[model samples]
Target: MSTMGRAGQAPMVVVDGVRKAFHGVTVLDGISFEVAAGDVVAFIGSSGSGKTTLLRCIDLLEPIDAGRIVVAGEAMGWHQQPDGRWVRDSERELARKRQHLSMVAQGFHLFSHMTALENVMEGPLTVKRLPLPRARQLAQELLAKVGLADKAHARPSKLSGGQQQRVAIARALAMGPEVMLFDEPTSALDPELAGEVLATMRQLAAEGHTMLVVTHELAFAREVADVVLMFHEGRIVEQGPPQEIFTRPAHEATRRFLARVTGGVPQPTGSS
Candidate 1:
């Protein structure tokens, strides 16, 4: 319900006191944040610290045990009834709500049997019921947007890791999501391959896509994020502008994390 944003517009995504658990182990604890339209918010933390889980909760790929996630003003996972009771939404309803957001995972989960263009066209054609010509056109445009126009006829196995990831990005974009969720999108790629995927993500940020990215790419976080959140033990311990979080982290956990990842606390990119 907190719509306050730097630009005075309602936020695109709101996660309020969200908590999630898996097999009796808490994964997300009291997580809350607001992603303003066009904001690129990066989440960083050690493995098992719950960064990816938070993205899953936001995408409704994993149900939160408590709290609410709202995207584009509609509650996800559950809806309130007239009698004041909260009820879980049906699978059909959840599918409809999922259209408001799209997620790209670490692994490029492309369909091996489909070409990049066919894979990108799958969502709009099947889920949105777009006409064949319209879906094809949209997929073509998105593939081009992600710099994969030439790879349209290539299958997943035929593409490089970076190219496959770019195709995955194009497929996500074909859905016309209001918010984009990235869960360690480049972690599975080699440095060279990761760079290409990162470049595509950077382009998305520049194009004003509201994004929530969970990543270990510290430089990307510092360079591209409007806000950087440091998660520890399933909680966000530090969050601020990238300069503050990267250069002047106030939390001990944050400092330790930076030291472990980058040898020591790194200064801002252009600092003397």
Candidate 2:
């Protein structure tokens, strides 16, 4: 795949021909996509479609077996040194590049022992290396941002699933990422609780935060995504603005998948 950087555009995140596998099975097959500054893109697909794998590849949690990933304008790939050490090309460069990105996963992954406030502060204190007092203050502010100020002292076990997920989001924001990747952030919550998390996401969208979300929440995607991508069998079968793809999908696989997901027949085009 060819790589080019456009002038007069802020570098966000790029995945080019990224391929990943586990054991003998290929999960992501030469996937390529770009997320622009302040754009909210949603990935929608049935199970085993590699949506989650693509998310992991972007975050470097799962290394791609082939292809390149560039985030915030820095390229990344492996290099072998003369001493036989397999080194990551531009490790320092990647570190600096990653400061612009943050990720939230399906599981809340909160610290069991720490209060919600401490969980939010941990990233700033460890990653940003801010002083303890400053981190605590910033954590409180972020918790309030997520509407969890009153629950600051609550532990993960004490908070509802939605509240815990909000704290997880607050933790991600503490790292000061320019773009956030959410992997099914509301999947584990009940419907009402999930609405709470979605509301927080909507607020972030209104603030113009660049975000890419992997989710099965079709309603949320229809409501908030600027662009929606439909994945099937390790490839993107369809993508477009939410209205076009959801209301007038051009691909049969997309229509079938949507039918299964929404539990209704795909609506005929131009139907009222």
Candidate 3:
């Protein structure tokens, strides 16, 4: 493994020849992709197709057995030393490189004891070591951005599922991340509540945030994604602009998966 900043013209996030496995089962095989700044890319596939695993690898949440992950042009991995011993980079180095990325998971992972305001402020005040006053100010602004300003003082338990997920989004924003990753961010919510979370995400997309999301929401992917990746088994079988991938998929596996989940041709209608 090696670590270095991306050269000029490099993508914000790049995965090259990445492969991962658990026990003897492979989850991702020779996966590769690049996401430029402000791009909205969505990963769609059937369950167990490794969509979530790919997202996790990008964030270093799950270490890959082989491959290179570069974020904001910084490549991350263990480095070989001159003494014939492999030396891993310090955690502090990795932390510094990851400062500009944030992730929102399917399950809203909020601190139960903290109010919505505090939850959003924690990342800045703690990890970033920002001043309390400054953190609070930013937190409030982010909560407002997510349409949760009125629920700032409410604890996670007091908020609805949709409200909680919104707070999670706010918390991720507090880090001022350049790239945001969402792994099925709305999968846990009911239809009505899921709309609220998706609305917040749509707003982010409109504001030109670079985002990569793994989701089963085909309509949402079609509406918000600039590029759509169809993962089958353990690799990306097909990828292209949403219109092409959704309507003129080039792979049999992709067409079959889409047909099973979407029930025939996908209409050009936007997701509600």
Candidate 4:
């Protein structure tokens, strides 16, 4: 995909006409968007609207059939050959490119056996071959950033669900990714716990991290997103700043979906 933004600054993440499908059913149909550095872009819609699938495509967990995805000017999955033809990337090459991103799913995907600190440190230690002492130091700092410093020694089973997810976020941060992809990061948490996770995310956004979040939490999208995308039938039906999209949606599907989930208008009154 082509990069965007003012004069010299290229967009951090670019998805141009990307498409994905499963068994003849299209999940993402020629969806395109660009996220500038430090921008928070939220994908919101009803269930099965392809919100999460779009996140998967950006992270390269699901390959796109057509179009391109780029993060920090690095192309994913495919590369140019000497003859000018494009070819699918090798497993090793794909793995290397995927390292530029950090993905946090709705589910906490931590190693059950490792403590919170160890779980966070695993990536830097193994993937980057960082020294153990340096990795542990960074891991502790990230755990503190996520408000899980006190739970560093606790394993996944020992911590509450919210704390586990926080650890997952910390683990992702450990790798120092250029773009963070979150797919319903708080979907599995209760309201009280979800607030804790959202608070951490808000802090990250304020600190200038570029992020792509797929969420059903209208309040978070309204407050934290620089842009809101309404997905329908595998395409972005409408998108704009949160104010325009939430208060005066331009698309019928956007209006209907917002009305149904939000019970009317999706306005945030400072509560998550």
Best TM-score goes to which candidate? 1
- Candidate 3 lDDT, tens digit per residue, 1-272? 11221345557788888999999899999898888778889999899989899888777677888888888767665555798775555788667766768999999999999999999999999999999999999999999999989999999999999999999999998999989999999999999999999999999999989999998888889889988888999999988778888878799998898888877755554333
Give all candidates' CA lDDT scores. Answer: 0.90, 0.85, 0.86, 0.88
Task: Provide the global lDDT of candidate 2 against the true structure.
Answer: 0.85
Best by lDDT: 1
Location of the lowest summed lDDT over 10 successive residues in candidate 3: 1-10
Angstrom error of the Cα, residue 179, model 4: value is 0.3
Candidate 2 collision pairs: none
Give candidate 2's TM-score.
0.89
Q: Sort the predicted structures by lDDT, highest score first.
A: 1, 4, 3, 2
Query: What is the C-alpha lDDT profile of model 4 across 1-272, one tens digit per residue?
Result: 22235456888888889888899999888999888898899998888988888888777788888888988888898888999998888998887888889999899888998999999999999998999999999999999999889999998999988898899999999999998989999999999999999999999999988889999888888889888889998999888778888888899999899889888855553323
Candidate 4 residue spans exceeding 4 A from truth: 1-4, 265-272
- Regions more than 4 Å wrong, model 1: 1-4, 268-272
Residue pairs with backbone atoms closer than 3 Å in model 4 (clashes): none
C-alpha TM-scores of all predictions = 0.95, 0.89, 0.91, 0.95
Better of 1 and 4 by TM-score: 1
Query: What's the candidate order when arranged by decreasing TM-score?
Result: 1, 4, 3, 2
Q: Give the better candidate number (1 or 3) by lDDT.
A: 1
Better of 2 and 4 by lDDT: 4
